[model samples]
Target: MSGSDRRRGVIALREESCTVCMLCVRECPDWCITIDSHVERVPAEGPGGRPRTAHVLDRFDIDYALCLYCGICVEVCPFDALFWSPETDYAEPALGDLVHGKERLGEWLGSAPGAAQPDGQSASG
Candidate 1:
């Protein structure tokens, strides 16, 4: 298969789309993903309504040194916040440098591949 047809690669995360649900952390076979969040109160929609609590992401980090590149984290994310980035040049001189933070992970979004079109379907179809 050609390069475009292959899907295995590093993960790209969208912090805005992530709800800090911890699904990715729980599902990771290598336990490479780490997330920290805190509950925040948001204004209610109507008067006298109770404020809604949401999880505000504080930290999201992935240790590439321990990752197996299995793509399980991407599959378990319900919010579509995780994706496969075609970029493969993330080698680091030290093991500590392999652990990427939220900002670094989000940067990979720019190189992430677009959603695949359905098989046997053309854009004009």
Candidate 2:
């Protein structure tokens, strides 16, 4: 896709870089991030099969209406799971429209725009 086809302002997750330390989970102040496990299928090239990987993210919700966008959670994430993106065209007419959960968080993970923080350097993961 071309650059114009992309989103302009938002926040997102970098899953591959996620260390699952749960710092964002704990520091959210909003109970946004929830840890969970799931079955993952490795690539067929390897001795692959469905294996249960601790997703660590049962949910990573953000209540935009209530979100001060303080970037507090972003700053506290040790694995760089929380980040700001230039894709903020979110629209919701009702208050309930602001309760974003796992699916939305995962969507951000799927199409964010940069590299995550390096592993091992600790902030709060």
Candidate 3:
């Protein structure tokens, strides 16, 4: 397998794929990930069916200042929401700006890689 696809500069988030499970935030040893979500009741499928609750992601932020770049969040994420982005130019002018919001993280999707297979091959391949 070719190693040209390696780009571990920064972590990016795929908001759509994320179920707000909080696994990444909880697994981060540096406590750099922060996620907030709200529960919404989904309508029943049919007559006499009961409604179910779904987690709506409200906020998901990652503070690069405290991040260890350990890739733990990407590994622990069961929903395949996080990935390593080749975007290393996201340097902040201020300390507070280092905390990237969900929108900002999603913007890096241009370079974010697809899900990888166990054999070091992209799932799409």
Candidate 4:
């Protein structure tokens, strides 16, 4: 495929940006995306303000063995934390190795395509 051609690439996750909303998990037809998070209370910004709770990501894994490459999870990510990485050559000797965690997914972010421009032009344009 040419450089401009879009590939049915692997999924890349930005764990820091993810809100752990479970939208991707619920939208995945193959049930390949797994996420675990916890709620933590943070001190109020002001004296009269109530404490705020934040979701801390504990675990995020995607079983490529079960994934259909349908991009449902990517589309359902409200936080834009999920992306399509063109580096799809992640073949492994063992089937278990195909199940990638957050670290592995994050690595792909380096090679993933940049975000589109607001004027509907490709980043390269």
Candidate 5:
């Protein structure tokens, strides 16, 4: 696929931008996105500020086996955490292996924007 065609290609995740919000999970018609997280107490960044609880992501996975490739998850993500990747060479020997964990999902993150892709869209995939 061409670089400009990532919207219809595979999915990539940016873990840093994700807030552990469940919008993608709840909005997915196929319920393919899986995430594991917990709340942590974050100390105030400055004096006279209040501490707050934050969701810490422990695990995040996407089951391509169940995904419809409908782009719903990508579109519904409030943060730009979910984006499309033009790399389509992913193939799993077993169906279970299609459940891509956060690390694998993030493999293509370097190809996110300004970088060129295998499709030569940017200049990174």
Candidate 6:
């Protein structure tokens, strides 16, 4: 399989599906859920100066590199903005690349949240 066709194993969101409730935003222990919205704007003009198109996703990502997947972010989301999907095919050529940001997690946002993330997280046994 080509690297372009591979998938990420972390969770993310659906913008339209997100109600901007800030549930997941609050519950995230890693402080990873960065949300960009329509509220913050410069107030420019559009094609016809018709109150130019706003609502930009400046940042809506999870640092899978940092994400413990404690599921707190998923549990707190009242709008069902986040979720875990069946796809978990993330492979990184470098350690830095393995860190999943917002764009990558956006694909599988669901309504399911799991248990709390364990503290003192380390990959070692």
CA-RMSD of model 2: 9.2
lDDT of 3 by residue, 52-71 (tens): 99999999999999999999
lDDT of 4 by residue, 62-120 (tens): 99999999998888888878889887689999989899999999888766676443456
Over 1-125, each residue of candidate 5 has an lDDT whose tens digit, in order, gives 86565454578887877899889999999888889999999999898999999998889899989999998888898777787776677889999988988888788666555334435554222
Judge candidate 5 at residue 62 and give its lDDT: 91
Q: Model 4: which ten-residue window has the lowest total lDDT?
A: 115-124
Model 5 misplacement above 4 A: 1-7, 114-125
- Count clashing residue pairs per candidate: 0, 9, 0, 0, 5, 7
> By TM-score, is 2 or 3 better?
3
Clashing pairs in 1: none
* Deviation from native of the Cα of residue 36 in model 5, angstroms: 0.7
TM-score of 3: 0.83
Residues 47-92 of candidate 6: C-alpha lDDT, one tens digit per residue: 5554434455556766566777687876677755566654567767
lDDT of each: 0.83, 0.60, 0.83, 0.83, 0.80, 0.59
Candidate 3 runs further than 4 Å off: 1-6, 115-125
- Per residue, candidate 2 scores C-alpha lDDT tens digits across 12-111 of 7665556667676577776645555454554445465454444544445677776656567778876666666665657788987877765666566444
Model 6: residues >4 Å from true position, as ranges? 1-9, 40-56, 99-102, 109-125
lDDT of 3 at 99: 95
Q: CA lDDT of 82 in candidate 2?
A: 65
What local lDDT does model 4 show for residue 70?
Answer: 92
- Pairs in steric clash, model 5: 115-124, 116-123, 116-124, 117-124, 117-125
How displaced is residue 21 in candidate 4, in Å? 0.4
